[model samples]
Target chain A: MSAADTILFVAAWLGLALLVAAFLLTVWRVVRGPTLPDRVVALDMLVGIVIGFIALIAIRTGFTLYIDIAIALGLVGFLATVAFARFILASKGRQGAGVYSAGAPLQDTAPAPDATHVAARGARGKSAAKSAKVAARTSGKTSAKKSPKSLPASPAVAELASVPAASPAIAPGKAAEEKPSAKSIGKPANKSASKTVSKSTSKTRSKSAEKTAGKAVTKPGKPAKGE
Target chain B: MDVVFAIFTAILILGGAAFALVAAIGLNRFPDVYSRMHAASKAGTVGSGLLLLAVGVHSGELSVLARALAGFFFFVLTAPVSAHLLAIAALKAGYSMSDKTVTNEME
Candidate 1:
C-alpha cells in the first residue's frame, strides 16, 4: 500500500481503539453511578460517545448518511436527558431511599413525600424546596397543602394516591388541579408534567382523566377551569 | 499538494485519537462525577472536533467540509450544555462532590 493509504489505515485503527475505550469508560460510569442522575448523565455521555463513533465510521467509510445519524442522535440524546432530569426531579425521594443508599432494604413506604421534602429542602435550601413544592402542587392538590413548601416530597404521596385503585379517577382530578402550576413552572416542567400525566392517564384509562390530560397538554401555560 | 494534505490528515487524526484516549483514561480515573464530567466534556469535544477537521481535510470536498464544520459546532454547543445540566441535576439531587475537590463555588 502507498504511504498515504498506510497512514489512513493506521489512523482508522487508532480512532477505533480510542472510541472503544471511551465507550467502555462511559459504560463504567453508568454501572458505578451512586445516584440515578449520575447514571442518567453517564447514559447521556454514552450517547455522545456513540455519536463520535458514528462520525469516525463515516470518515473511514465515506458515508455522509452517518453524519446525519450523528445529528439525530444528538437531538434525541438531548431529549432523553431532559426527560430523565424531569423524572429524577419528579420522583425525588423514592429514588434516594430505594437506589442510592447502600444496603438499605427497599421499603414500599420508604419514598414518603415528607422524607423527600426534607431531603430536598436540606440539600438545596429554599429554592429547591420552592421548585419541588411547585412540582408537587402540579401533581396533586391534597398533598400540596400538607407542606406548601415541601414540593419534592409530594411525589410519594401522589404516587400512593395514584396506585391502581377503585378511585383512579380521583388521582386524575388532583393531577388536573395542578396543571396550571405546571404551566407557570416553564416549558421544561410543562413538557415533563404533560408526559407523566399522559402516562398515568393512559394507564388509568378514565375518560375524564384523558380529557383533563388532553386539555392540560393543549392549553399549556393557560389555567383551565379546574383551577 | 496531495502528500502535504495526507500528512496533515494523518497528524490530525492521530492527535485527535490520542486526546480521546486520554479523555477516556481521565473519565475512568476521576474520583467524582463532576471531575469526570470536566474531563469528558473538555477533552472529548476537542478530540471530536479535531477528528472532524481531519475528515474535512481528507475529503477535500466543500460538502464534506461543511458537514464536518457543522458537526464540530454542534459538539461544541451541546457538550457544554449537557455537562452543565448534568452538574446542576447532580447537585440538586444531592450528589456531593468528592472530598478531595477543593472548591468553594458550589457552597
Candidate 2:
C-alpha cells in the first residue's frame, strides 16, 4: 500500500474506535437518565455519534453518498428533539405519582420504589425547576380541594379529587344526601376515584384518606361527589 | 498531491474523533441536562462537522467537498437552535437544576 493509504487506514481505524466508545457512553446515559430531558439529551448525542460513524464509513468505503445520509439524520434528529421538548411541556400538569414528571425532585415527590432511579438523575440548574417542584407540592396539597371545584381536566387529578369523597367515614347521612349528586358525576369520576383509592391504599393510606375527608365534607360536597 | 490530501484527511479524522470522545465524556459526567446539552451541541457539532470535512477531503473532489462542507455548516447552525428550544422547554416544564448548582440568574 502507498504511504497515504497506510496513514488513512490507521486514522480510520482509530476514529472508529473512538466513535464506538462514544456510542456506548451515550447509550449508557440514555439507559440511566432519570428524567425525560436527560434521555432526550442522550438520544441527541447518540444521533451525533451515528453521524460520526457514517462519516467514518464513508471515508473507509470511498462512497460520498453516505454524507447525504448523515445530513438527513441530522435533520431528523433535530426534529425529534423539538418534538420531545413539546411533549415534556405538555406533560407539565401530570404530577401525581408519575415517574416521568420533570422537576419532581429526588427527595420529596418521587416515591420510595423509584428513589434509586431518580436519585442520580440531574436537572439543569434553574430556579424554574425548584419553582415547579414547589408548585407541584402546593398543587398536590390543595389538589384534593381543587379537584372538586375544577373537576380536574385530567383523570389523574380527578382521582385525587375522589379520595375523600369515596371514604365511608363521612357521615352516611350526609353521604346519602350527596349520593344523588355524586351519581351524576358518572362512571369516569368513579373510575378515577377507584384509582386514587388503590393508589392511596399503597402509599399514605390513612393520611390521604382523612385529609381528603376533612376537606371533602365542606364545599367539595358538590364537585367531589364520588361515585 | 495524494500524500498531502491523505495527511490532511488523517488529521481531520483524528481531531474529529477526539472531540467526539470529549463530548461523550462530558455528556456522561455533566450534572444536568443543560450542561450535557452544552457538551453535545458544541463539541459534538464540531466533531461531526470535522468528520464531514474529512469525508469531503478524502474524496479529493471539489464537488464532494462542497457537499460535505454544506452538511458541516448545517450541523453548526441547527445544533444551537435545537438545544435552545429544548432547554427552554425543560425549564418551562420545571426540570430542576442539580443541587450542586451555585447560581441561577434566570430564577
Candidate 3:
C-alpha cells in the first residue's frame, strides 16, 4: 500500500471513531434534556451525525450510492425537524389549557382583590364594622380604577361591596347599598367597570372572583345556616 | 495524482471528524437549548458537509462528486433553517432560557 492509501485508511478509521463518539453524546442529550425542544435539537444533531457516518462509509467502501442515501437522509431529517416544530406549536395550546394561559391574565386582577383583602384584614384588626366599610370601598375602588371611559352601570357593585366584607357588619351595608345603586355608587360604581378592566387587563382571574362572589351572594342562605 | 488525492481525502476526513467531535462536546456542555442548537447545527453541518466532500474526492468521478457537492450544499442550507424553526417553536411554546443568559432580546 502507498503512503496516501495508508493515510486515507487511517483517516477513515479515525473519522468513524469520532462519529461514534458524537453519536453517543447526542444520544445522551436526547435522553437527558429537560424540555421537549432540547430533545428535538439533540435529535436534529443525531441526523447530522448519521450523515457523517454515511459519508465516511461511502469513502471507505468506494460506493457512491451512499452519497444518494445521505442526500435523501438530509431531506427526511429536515422534514422531521419541521414537523416537530409544528407539533410543539400545536401542543402549546393544550399546555395553556392547564396553567400558564389561565393564570397569566389573572395575575393582573389578582393583586387588586388581594390588596382589598389585606386592607380588610387590617381594618378587621380594629373593628368589624370599620373593616366591612373599608373592604367594600377598596374593592369597589380597585374594580373602578380601570377604564373610566365606558361604565355600563352594573348593579353588581352592590354584590362586590358585600363580597369583600367577610364580617357580618356587611348586613347593614348590604341593605343600605341595595336601597339605591346611587349610595355606594361613588366608589367603582358598577360591575361593567370591573368587567371591562378585567377584559382589557386580565380576564380569567377577575372573572373567577366575580363568579365566586356571585355564587356566594346567590347562596346567601348557606352562609346564614353556617353561622 | 492518486497519492495526492488520497492525502487530500485523508485531510478532509480528519478535519470533518474533528469538527463533528467539537459539535458533540459543545452539545453536551452548553447551558441552554439554544446554545446547544448553535453548536449542533453550525459545527455539525460543517462536519457533515466536509465528510461529504471527502466522499466526492475519493470517488474521482464527476457525477458522484456532483452528488456529494449537492448533498453538502443541501446540508449547509437546511441546518440553519431547521434550527431557526426549532428555536422559534421552543420560544413560543414557553421554554425558559438559561439563568446565565445575560440578555434576551427575543422576548
Cα lDDT listed for each candidate: 0.59, 0.67, 0.67
Off by over 4 Å in 3: A93-227
- Higher-ranked by DockQ: 1 or 2: 1
Each candidate: RMSD: 15.0, 16.2, 18.5
- Model 2: which residue pairs collide? A124-B97, A125-B97
Model 3's lDDT to the true fold?
0.67
Pick out the ten consecutive residues of candidate 2 chain A with the lowest summed lDDT.
A113-122
- Which stretch of 10 consecutive residues in model 1 chain A shows the poorest summed lDDT? A100-109
DockQ of each: 0.31, 0.30, 0.33
For model 2 the TM-score comes to 0.62
Candidate 2 lDDT, A105-223, residue by residue in tens: 21133233222111112122243223223332223433323323222223453453464453332332332233323313211212223343233222322222222333322322332
lDDT of 3 at A54: 93
Give candidate 3's fnat, 2 decimals. 0.82
| Cα error, candidate 3, residue A21 (Å) | 0.6
lDDT of 1 by residue, A1-227 (tens): 87877777787787788778878877876776655666776777677667667767876897866777777787798778777777766653233322111111111212335433433343244544544533342334443565555545556545644443422222434333453343232112122233453333322223223333233233322222333
Model 2 segments more than 4 A misplaced:
A95-227
**Deviation (Å) of A163 in candidate 3:** 46
